[model samples]
Target: MNPYKEIENEILNASHILITAHKSPDGDSVGSSLGLLHFIERLGKKAVIGHPDPAPEFLQWLEGIDSILYMERDGEVLKNHFQKADLIFCLDYNATDRVGPEMQQLLKSTSAKKIMIDHHLNPENFVDITVSATEVCSTAQLIYELIEQSGHADLLSEKIGTALYLGILTDTGSFRFPSVQPRTHEILGKLLGAGVSHHLIHEQLNDNNTVARLQLQGYAMSEKLEILDSCHAAIISLTEAELTRFKAQKGDTDGLANLALSIKGIRIAVCLYEKEGKIKMSFRSKGQENPVNILAEEHFDGGGHANASGGISELGMDATLKKLKTLLPVYYKSDK
Candidate 1:
């Protein structure tokens, strides 16, 4: 319990602080970065966020998002911050390579005492102090614990709570994921007590979708969703041409895998779509019987939780689909 108070002491001593997350930032990464940024500001200190890339459009409505420095577009500004930083907080991502090439190089070169707050499995040894709890649903949860253990409960303002709440909410799939614990609810209660206005957060997250996103999702589900009756698995694939035709933006297909998994007979759901000339995959499974992380790690260059994982398919859609179908019997557990 609070061994050496390392995180607390570091925040107090560091002058130039920088926060960062992985490339193609998701809800958890965006939420945790902004949340920690707000938390540090509440301590009357200055910290800048140097994200590797832009966050999804759905999360842009959150406060302080505009201040983020992207490595792609704001290279000079981020470089300056990286050079002068005395402490770097790597959020959401584990390995240094997750930040992409240029940002990864900067992270490797920086002598700033790096502390990582992540919930991913198999954290790398790049950071000086790593607060990784794979059991926690999201990195935002770990941030809250840090705040509490640091004796800064008074600093948990509405803004900070809202940002953290978004992280925990999306990552846990609204507390439905198996990773969620009873303590998760207790932390959520504190966030609500601190005026998170969760209903509004939900609306802001889900309601502001563009018409293009709706049409794209609709087309993907109706036309692309393929059910393998033998193994009770579902798969959806979208090509680059189709994504461009609908003007699909980032986060447009965020929850489509979950949608496929909701079907009565489906136990495993896989969503593959072309992006930047590579096929990206999201795999979802129903219960403990089928763990998709193994399939993801072995077949695709990806890994995460047992139930929800990500993978990449360098092979084109046609070949990737054939390979996936061929491997389904080996990975999926049939309901015999």
Candidate 2:
């Protein structure tokens, strides 16, 4: 059977289901979860979203945001729901490990079937049903198709449209990323037709930044920024102390990678952040001149797209930055 058909069958049979995403959920994960939640509730089935932390206030405007259950280090409520769920919709991830150690244990212990819906490369084959279209821009687009396939298209309420639109908008970097497609624009038109307010969502997402965040951006530009190979590569690293000083939240580092790409001669951009004893790296490249995922996977055990990727490293700041300085030239030829 086709992947979409298989997922549709699973949804039809499931009575109680749990939907979740990776740790440090992004707009795609949170929006897709809420979009699915709205669609499921419209079907008269019981659906709930499990998130490790509260989504930022910018996203609180989406429907069913109030119903999300926040799970701590070892949340008993999430454990109970995981055990009772007939199925689990693992949205926007390739592996159960992405959900963190505690949630992974609950998932393994439960009898619920795992269904994966994602738009990432290198899918893990652990789930019972997998519907991954790496060519698609966002998981929200896939969820929209799932609803349409299941004959639930008309059930897409204004709430569902807004949530899904946020997923597409943020994942595509406000429609500036290369992933933005014509179909994405078509979907946006349909969403507006459904009464979803684009201006309000944009304002809520953009205007809610605190003064500390602005100061943090200034600090990053001043202290952390580095241009390598005569601006062929750019990098920024944020220490934990700097994050504390700036009151930087988990997703506050969202646009720092893009900042490097803004340089005229830059081909590759990297952002390294220290969090919980590990250095998290976000990489991006422009055009076809940079092999970003290869550099990340080889150096830091991470892989993503050519223009965007990420990985984690145990190598301390000085060492990691040293490695990036040396390795960047291997993948890119500087016009300088």
Candidate 3:
């Protein structure tokens, strides 16, 4: 029996549906949620999209993005939808904590049947139906597969196709990541057939950067980047003052960590930025030399994929940098 058959049945039975993604919602999370929203509406069912926080400004151009309720800003509206929802679809995240504390509590208290469609490792068993495919490139790919396999291909509109395409493009690093496969290209073809403009999407996501954002990137590379040649590691730290000086926005430093990773000898790249009184860290590594997720989980109290992970430290910027430098030798040994 096809697993998606169960998912289809659940959707058929549901009337009032609610969709949500993790906090600090990225392209994949927001795109998959909106794509699924369009899918649900095509089924003649009413669905509401919610997120723990607002999406980045770049994603606001997506169709139906304005309708997504931010749980942090619109608690009552989200709570009301949560109460009335017959089914909830959780996209792109595994754990309830990924939705933040208040929304996590609401999710736990809700009686609605939950469905999870994610492409992440170690999913928590909190949902009724779990479609956790870590092998897939992104949750958007899984959604496209679900729709194609379940014989609902005709329900896909240009808006839905564009959202799905954005998710795949960004999450796979514009088809540069190893996770991308031939099937990903096939899906891209289908999305293109559905009228998604690839060039426009690329321009919107990448070319629409502000001058302040470019200045922030320049300052980070020149002034903040620190290299450990012996360990082949690079670290970048940005203080709140620096961010304010450049008028940094939510997505300003989106791909800044990758800049460090691009260095010739840098095997491990770490970006630490102060935000809201906490030091937020993003770890990126090349190949399988070092599993950044393990290091992040063990020391930084956070985890994600092997190559890419994020964590937070309550300590100040200086202390966090010192701690990271101290641990660098342990993870990236001189011999290795």
TM-score of each: 0.98, 0.93, 0.97
Model 3, range 34-63, lDDT digits (tens) per residue?
Answer: 898888788787789989999888888999
User: Highest TM-score: which candidate?
Assistant: 1
Model 2 Cα lDDT, one tens digit per residue, 271-320: 99999888999998876456588888788888766678888988888888
Please tell me which model should have the higher TM-score, number 1 or number 2.
1
Off by over 4 Å in 1: 1-4
For model 3, the superposed segments whose C-alpha errors exceed 4 Å read 334-336
Residue 18 miss distance in model 3 (angstroms): 0.3
Q: What is candidate 1's lDDT per residue for 1-336, written digit by digit as tens?
A: 473268878988999999999988888899889989998888888999999899988999989999999998999999999999999999998898889999999999999999999988999999889888998999999989988888888889899999899999999887788899999999999999999899999999888988899999899889999999988999999999999999988889899999999899898999999988799999998777788999999999988888899999999999999999999987775753
TM-score of 1: 0.98
Evaluated at residue 324, the lDDT of candidate 1 is 96
lDDT of model 2, residue 22: 78
Q: What are the root-mean-square deviations of the candidates from the true structure over C-alphas?
A: 1.2, 2.0, 1.2
